[model samples]
Every structure is written in structure tokens, then in C-alpha cells.
Target chain A: MSQFFTAAVLTSTVAAGIALATPFLLAALGETLGQRSGVINLGVDGIMLLAAFATYYVALRTDDVLLAILAGMGTGLLMGVVTAAVSVTLKAEQGISGIGVYLFGLGFSDLLFQKLVGTPLPITTPPQVGIPLLDQIPVLGGMFFDQSPLVYLAFLLVPVVAFVLNHTTYGLKIRAAGENPAAADSLGVSVARIRWSTVLLGCTFAGLAGASLLLYDGIFQVNLTQSEGFIAVALVYFGAWRPSGVMAGSLLYGLVGAIILTWKSLGIIPLSGSDLAATAPAVITVLALLFVARRFRQPAALGKPYEREA
Target chain B: MQRPVHRRALPALLAVAALVAAACGSSSSPAPVSSAAAPASVAPAASSSVTPAPAATAPASAAAAASGATSATTLKVALVAPSAVNDLAFTQSMVEALNSIKARYNLQVAISDNQFVVSTAANVIRSYASQGYNLVIAHGSQYGSTLQQLAPQFPNVSFAWGTAGSTFNQPNIFAYQANSNEGGYVQGAMAAMLSTSKVLGVIGPIAVGDAKLYVDGFCAGAKSVDPTISCIPVYTGSFSDVSLFATAAKTFVSNKADVLTGTAQAVVGAIGVARADNLPWFGTQWTQVSLAPHNVVSSQIYNWAPILEQIITEIRGGKLGGATYTVTLGNGGETIQFNSGFNLPANVKAKADELIKGITDGLVNVPQ
Candidate 1:
């Protein structure tokens, strides 16, 4: 424990935490937007898996990182469209439909991967783009600025997402559709359109999250996101549908996960109980959610489909 | 003015289903639910946790069985592995061994890869047994209980499984194991010798079977090389999640580990990290030099042919299982194949050769 407290160890752990947070922050930001618009796509993990595989396959063929990321976003866009159509236009149960989308994404991605790419191969990852002189600033630059472009992209989207959700006419319409769909419809604002937009954007972000995770390791395996998407869904709740809150939740999870990993590496955690220690991030996040649950109220019209009256 | 939402949306949902089904149709691997290939009685073992590989019938072997060209000489074998055939770990080792013996024995082989779900794997095992496959290998320890139930039902078919030495005292049930500890011992000794910082990191996938044996042997061997050497291990608690293994590797690298090694399929992720850090890596189960050509020191390849061939011959000799077989450094079941790519010092290479010989000759104890 004492050795774990060293400055070097702390810096390394925090640096890892920021890198680990990229996927969660990216996914949760999108989810936050979706939830803010009264939509909850439970298949974020599935979307990530599908997108991750697409990104991997594209990278394998083209050796182009940017193209691979686009491929991921495209896969996510398709999945998002599926999710939006099922939940919005089709008026299927959002929870069940989202799960259906997830199952399809999960199974389909795996099927495609096995069929197309039999073995897991390494691909070109997004090289870390350090912010020059800022990166040389002792521990801070390494902790925050010296990360993959995907990480920076994820963090940069927070402010953009916050602006879209809190300011502007589009943001107001989204809040209205989520909070009082009947009123929004009465005002001639298309609830379905707003939701479709949010779901599309959010799911696209989920796709970016998958690409980021792939870039993190530069490899793809079955279910490579490994419930990180599900964790992103949880983070939407942990964040209470705010971009800032989602960022904090993601960082907390990442930090806790990094600490546990650091402990395992340092042999501070016993071999027998290392598994239990590994569960710390999920456990702590869940506990935090429980504690934070009472303070945050969901949108009143959330999860209720708006069927316009004749 | 527009079409009804439910009426219009029905086609969209059907289209989605059709697209998914179409992709699955063109899949090279077997659809997740392999009960499609098995008889009607094989329950739908469609598990969501992991997808099973295709029920691939080895082309030459299948042709031989179809023609009955050499009825007396042909041996039909079915393999039900817990992971991908190309996992570079347990399943791949067995598949390679089976492939090695396939031509020599005129064996017809059928494979059901990625049957990680025990219940699903059990159904595949039973389907193979009922189909009159001469030998069915349920290749995971998790399938032990399933074998106990199914092996009794098929008295004529010989069932084999391992990385374990338990045959459940049932006739027609064969258990085989790899004394992976021996090779692991050699790997750990080599890693310790090669490591400059004397801090070696080990990654394990959930501490089960050979994964546990290999890591335990590694630590013991490392300690033997230098009593004061540090060989701490991190168990990633998953076999499929590459990111977890990568995270474990990054942590190891950050902690000043100059040498790295681990077990199971996802260890590729760790090997990637090792390659990035330019650290020496020891591998097991199958040759991982392809994953990290320059970084890999040597691999402990599980040549299951020696033990598996012994079981096949015993079955031919009218001894239908109820025995355990083990492959070791002594029995030629496991071997150390060093990578020609790495610039290994002559002294270190000689020491590794000596360690292998010492273990093969019972001079070294790979104990925890």
C-alpha cells in the first residue's frame, strides 16, 4: 500500500485511468444525450462490439486508422438507425427493442468477425498526440494531454454535447420532447425527429467509443468492449443525464479500475483475491449510483412513447 | 396522410432479422447454435456468452468416411473445444495435435470450436456421440460433469477431455492432461535469466487448469533461478477480453517488469504490450511467435498427439478408456520451441536446453 502511494505509481495509475476513461466517457456522453431526449438504448455494448469489429476489419484491410474509425461510426449509425426505428417509428418497447438490437449487434459482429477475420490480428492504433510543451509539464501533461486522438476527441465532445443539450433551439426542443412530449408535439416540434437525432448522435458516439477502445489496445476479440458499453449505460444514470456528470462518473470508474489494476501489478492485492479486487470499479460505481440515485430525477416523459391523439 | 406506423414498421423489423440471418448464413464459423447441424434431439445450446465455431468436417477425412474406402483403417473423431480453433492457447494446441495425427491414422475429424458454454458444449458432445463418432473430445474441464452424464449413455464411443487427469472411473471415458508445469518451469527459468531488472510479470486468465499450472510453474522456476527475483502475477478473470489482458500488461510494464509471460488465448493482448515495450516474453499452448516475432523467447507447445495417440491405440486394443493419460517433458507431449527471431545469448540458450533436459530427466521439481 505504501509503495502504491509513490508519486510515480500515482502518475502512472492516473494516466492509465484517463486512457481507460476514453471509451466510457465517449459512450456515456452519447447515452447522456439520448437519455436527455427520453430515449434509452440498452444495447450500447452491442453497438460498441459491432463498431469495434468494423473498425478492426477496416483497419486490417486498409491500414488506415481514420477510415477504420469512420467504419466504426458507420456501423454505429446503422445500429442507431435500427434502434431509432424500433423504438421511435415502430413504437416498439424501447427497453426490449434496444436489447434486440444489442443481441443482433453482439451475435452479428461475432459472426462477421469469425467469417471474415478468423484470427484476432493487431492493427494500427491511433498514435498518441502529445500537446508538445504541455506534455513536458511534469505529471499533468502525461496524465491529460499525452493520449490518443480518440481520447482527446472523447473529452472535447463533452463541451460540444453539453452545449447541444443545454443551449440552442435544438437543445430546448430535445428537453421539451423528453420532459413533456405532448407539449412538444402541441408546439409542432417533432418528438420523434428530436429523438431520432439524439439516438443517432448518441449511438454514433457509442460507435466512436468502440473505435477508441480498439485504438486503446489495437486488437479485437469477441465481445472486446467487455461490458464497457453496459457500464456506459450505467454511467448515464450515474451522471444523471448531464455531460459533466457523465464525465465525472466515467473518470471515477476509470480511476477505481486503474487503482485496483495498479494494486494487482504491485502485488498489493493477493493473488487469491485479485479477482475480487478487479471487481472494485464496477462495485464502487454501483454503490455510487445507489447513493446518487435519490438526488437525480429522470425526465417525466422518459420511456413513454408519445402517441399523438386524433 | 401516411401509412400506419405499426404496419409500415413491421417490414423494417423483418428486414433487420433477415439481414442478421443472411450474415449468419455466409459465416465461415458455425452459427452460434450448432444444434442446427446436430440431430433434432440435440437441445438448442444457443448461448449468448460465446459463439461456437463451425462444425467443420476435415475435407480429406470426411471424404474417406463418406466413401468408406478404408473402413477398417478409418477412425472418426469429433472435437468440442471451449474456444476458437485459432485461440493460440488450449483449443489450438489440441486442434494442431489432432491435425498432426489426422493423416497418419486416416482419421476423419469434425470440429465444434468456441463451445464455451458448458451446457451447449454438452449437447454438442452428446450429438457427436449419438452420431456414431468413434471418439468425442469434450475439450474443457468445465465439461467434466457433462461427460459424467453423457459418457454413460454412449458405451461404444470413447469420450476424452483435458488438461485434466480425471476419467470419472467410467469405462469409455478417457482423460488426458498436459504436464504444462514442466514447460512452464523452463519458460520461467528462461524469462528470469533473460530479464534484466529481475522483475518478471505474469498474466493469467482466471487461474484454471493449465493456466494456473503454467503460471505456478513459472513463478516457482523464476524463484529457483533467483530466490530474490520478483514474479508477481495478475489474473485478468477472463479468457476473451483482450483489453483486460492489455491493461494487466501495461500495469506490469509501468511497474518496471523487464520480462513478461502469461497463459490462455487473450495473452496475445499482453504479448502486444510486451512487444511495444521490447520486453522478452515466454509463451505456452501454441507458438505465439507470429504475434510477437521478435519479442518471444520460446513457446511451450502442447503436442497432444503423444498422449492422445496412446489413448486411440488403447481404444483399438479393446481397452475402452477408464484411464488417464499425461503428456510431459518426459513423455514428449509438451516441448519448448525457441523463436529463431530473438537474439538469445548462447549461454542463456544452453541454460534453457539444460533446464528442459533436467526437468525431462526428473532432476528438477516444478513445485509451487
Candidate 2:
């Protein structure tokens, strides 16, 4: 317990928390965009799985992080297009269709992995790039600045996402599409187009999220996402579909996860209940949702497929 | 309007169906490849009377002689694993063991990996048995119930499954388990002695089966070295969540733990964390030194070759089941492999060696 109070321990915990949060942040921010446009994509986890495997495969073959990331994003784009085609163009029920996408991603990724990489092989992770002056700052520097390029980009996306949603014509159309797609359609906005684009954008971010996770550990296996993708989608509701709120929710989750682990390590939590301690993040998420559910107004036509007049 | 909806929906649904069919097609294709490699000599009736030549027969002669006139009597074994054959963990250990004894017994080995789903595994197990394989090994504890039900149906084929001790008292079923606590004790003793902060962390997959035994033994071993040494054991409640493992490992490091260890496949994530912090890591189930040579001090490798040999010998002697095999320090079934890359202290290595000897010699009784 005394060890938990030390400066070094606190700094590392913060750093670890950020590392854990980055994947969720990226995925949730993407989900936020889609939800704002009224297309709910529950297939984010599937997207992440396929992207993670694709990214790992490319990185293993080419040894180029750029190409690997592009491969990951490309996989996501492919999956995204499929998802859009199903829920948007085909007018299927969004929830059930998303599950289909999830199962496809899950099974397809496993199949591809078994066929391509039958065994676990180590790949070099992208090297960490510390900020010049910022990394030298006592505790905060190491916690925030001394991270991989992916982490910096995930955080950067937060503000970029917030600005776009509030201040742009495309963002306005997306919001309009979600809140009242019929009205948006009446005003010459293509509701289908807005929803399809938003879903695709969400999936692309999900793909990037997968690549970030693969880069973090440098290994891929079956179920590597471990439901982080599902949690990211849920975070959309937890954050009220707002980018800033999503970031806060993601960080809270990351920090809580880090704290529980740290507490268990220091014996601050009893060994007997360690399994229960692992459930801290999920329990907290549920409680946060319950607290905010009453006040939140989700998009009116979030899951409805828009069919323009014939 | 209806026609347009139908046209768009048809192509989308067809695309999804085609993709799903491709996945199923690829996953199902491995089964036939395994079944196709089945030896021609394994007659359906011979499976019931699979009594190999006496143990005194030179095992090398068996392979050569079997290829000639005795091919009808050669052992054909099928292994169904829950994960990839080369997961570098539980499944891999059995695969390597099977490979080791393949040539000596004139054994034809067939492997079905990634059988995480029980129904799929049951079908595969039954398929192997019905195909007249001499011995079918279900290499996961999750398959225990399935094996219990299936073992009785296949009276002619010898059944082996583990990471467990129960054989259902069946005549044709063999059970094997590792005395993992023995090696865990040794690892804990070394970590206790070498930890600079007197803190050690154990990232367990779940508190059941061998995982529970290993964690209990590890804590006992640490306390034995220094009664006050802080040994924290945490179960992530999952065996596949690499992110959770990494988080747990980082937390341990953050709390000033200079030594860490974990079990199961997820330990790869924990090992990566240990490497990043330059902390010493102890491993179990397989040799993990390859994963992080610089940080992995030692690994308790599960050498199931000896056990496999014994099982084969018994099957040859017409004694199929009603027994259990345990891998311990005394038997060559489990051995602690120290990493040459890690600069372990001389005294710490000596102490670890002494502990191993003591456990093997019955002077040390590891906690259950």
C-alpha cells in the first residue's frame, strides 16, 4: 500500500492507463460520429478483430508500419462498406445486421489466422517516440508525452472530432440525419448518404483502433480485441454520444482498470476477491450509464434505415 | 419501391452468405486433411484389439518393422486441441509431446486445433474414434465431460484427456495431469530471493484447475523464503484477454514489484510488460524464454513426452485405463528451464536448483 503512494508508481500507473485507454478512445470517438448520424454499428469489435489480424499480417510480411496500418484501415473500410451495404442500402434491422457482421468478422479473422499464421510468431512493435521537451517534465511528461505516435494521434482525434461535429456542414448534416432523417431528407439532404458515410467513417476509425492495439503488443491471436470493441460501442451511450464526453468516459475506464490492477498488485485488494476486482470497469460503466440514462436523449432515428421517396 | 428494396437486399444478403460460407469452408477443410492422412492399415476391427508388441521390443525396431509386415499393428493417435497447435502454451505442449513419440511408435498423428467450441470438439473426437484411431487424446480440461460421455461409446479406442486427473474409471480412458505446483514453488522461491523490492506479482488466468494450484504453490514458496515478502496473486478472470493481462502486469510493476510471473497463453502479454520494465519474469506451461529472453528468468516447462511414452507402453501392454499419470519434478515430465540470456545471480540459481532437488527428493512438500 505504501508503494502505491510513491511518485514513480503513480507516474507509471498514469502512463499505463493512457496506453490502455487509447484503443477504446479511438473506437468510441468513431462510434460517436456514427451514432450522431443515426447509424448504430455494433460490429466495431468485429472490425477491430479483422483489422488487427490484417495489420499484424502486413507488418509481419512487409515490416512497414505504414503499410500495416493502411492494410488495417483497408480491412476496416472493406468491413465498413459491407456493414453500410447491409444496414443502410438493404434496409435491414441495424441491431441484427450488426451481429451478423460481428460473427462474420470473428469467424473470418479466426479462419484467416489459422490459414495464414498457424502459429504465434513475434513481430517488432513500433518504437515509442518521446516528445522532445515535454517528455522531460517530471511525472506528467512521462505519463502524457512519452508515448508512441499512435497514442498522440488518438488523443488528437478527440478535439478534431469535437470540432467537426459542432462546426462543419457535413457534421450538421450528420446530426440532422440522426435527429430527424425525414426532415433532413425533405431539405434535400441525402439521409442515406449521410448515414452510410458516417458508418464507413466509424468503421475506418475502428480499423485504426485495431492497428493501434496490434502495435501495442506486437502479437495477434484469436479474440485479441477481447471485447474492447464492444465496450467502445457501449461507451457511445456512456458519453451521451459526445466526443469530449466519450474521451472522459474512455479515460475513466482506462484509469479505473489501471487502479484496480495496481491495488491488487499492492495487496490493497484482497486476493480472495481478485476476480471481482477484474469486473470493476464493467460495473462502473453500467453505473455511469444508469446515472446518465434519464437525462440523455439519444438520436430519434438512430437505428432506422432511411428510404428516400421513390 | 418494393422491387428496388428486394434487388439491393438480395445482393447484400448474398454477399454476407458467401463470406460466411467461405469462413466455414476453410475451417472445416482441416478435418478432412487430418482424416485423409489416416494409415491404411488401421482396420476398424483392429482398434478394439490394439495390443502392440511387448515393451521389450526395441521401439526403433517397431517403427521399421511396422512399415514392413507389422503396419497393421502400428499405433494411430489423434489429438484434439482447444487452441492453435503452436499457441506456445497448453495445446503446443501436447503437440510437441505427440511429435516426439511419433517416429518411435510408428504413430500416425492427426491434430484438430482451435476446437474451442465443445460441440465441434466432440464431433472431431468421435470422428477420430470411429475412424479406428488407436488412441484419441482430448487435450483440454473443457473436454473432460465430453470425453467421459464419448469414452464409453468407443470401447475399442483408448481415450486420453487432461490437464485433469479424472478418467471416469473407464477401462479405455487415461487421465494425466501436471504437478504444476512443484515448478511454481521453485519459480516463487527464485523470485522471492531475487526481487529487489521484496514484492512479487502473479497474473493468473483463472482460479481453477492447474492455474489455482500453481498460484497457491507460488505464494507458499515466496512466504517460505521471507515470511514478510509481499506476494500478490490476481486472476484476470479470463485466459484470452491480452489487454487485461498487460494492464495487470503494469499495475504490478507500478507497485514496485521487480519480479512477476503468470500462467496460460495470456502470459505473453504479461511477459511483454515485464520486458518493458526490465523486471524478471517466471513462466509456466511452456518455455517462454523465446518470448522475452532478457526478462524471463526461468520457465517451468511441461515435458509430457515421458508421460506419453508411459501411456503408449501401457496401451501396448493391453492396459488402457483405470490409472492416472502425473508430471512432477521427480519424473522427467516437468522441468524448470532457466534462461541463459537473463543474468540470474549465481546464488539465486543455486538456491532454485536446491529447491528443485529438495522437492524431487521428498524433502520439500509444495502446498496444494
Off by over 4 Å in 1: B1-16, B19-74
Q: Give model 1's DockQ, 2 decimals.
A: 0.46
lDDT digits (tens) for residues A1-310 of candidate 1: 9999876787788888888888999999988888888898888988999999999999999999999999999988988998888788777667767766776777777778777988767776666789989988887877787888888888899899889878889999989988988888999999999999999998999999998898788777766787899899998889888898999999999988888888888888888897778778888999999988789999877876667766
CAPRI level of candidate 2: acceptable
Q: What would the per-residue lDDT of candidate 2 be over residues B1-368, giving only the tens digit for each residue?
A: 12245656676677667656654644433353343233544422112112222322224334333344443466788898877666778878888887766665567788887777789889989998999988899988889999899888989899988888888878888888888999999889898999879988799987887888888888888888998998878788787777888778877776677899998777777888887777899988888877787989998888887767666665665666666778888877888999999999999899899999999899999988
TM-score of each: 0.89, 0.87
Best by TM-score: 1
DockQ of each: 0.46, 0.48
Least well predicted 10-residue stretch by lDDT in candidate 2 chain A: A119-128
In candidate 2, what are the lDDT values of residues A9-50, reduced to their tens digit?
788788888988999999999899889988898889989999
lDDT tens readout by residue for model 1, B1-368 = 12345664566567556544544442223232221122223221111111111221123233333333332456678889877777888888988877776665556788887776677778788888888888888888889999999988889999988866678888888887777888888888888888888899999987778888889999888888898999988887777778778888888888889999989878878888887778898999988887788999999998887656555555555556777767777767788999999999998899889988888788877784
Q: What is the lDDT of candidate 2?
A: 0.81
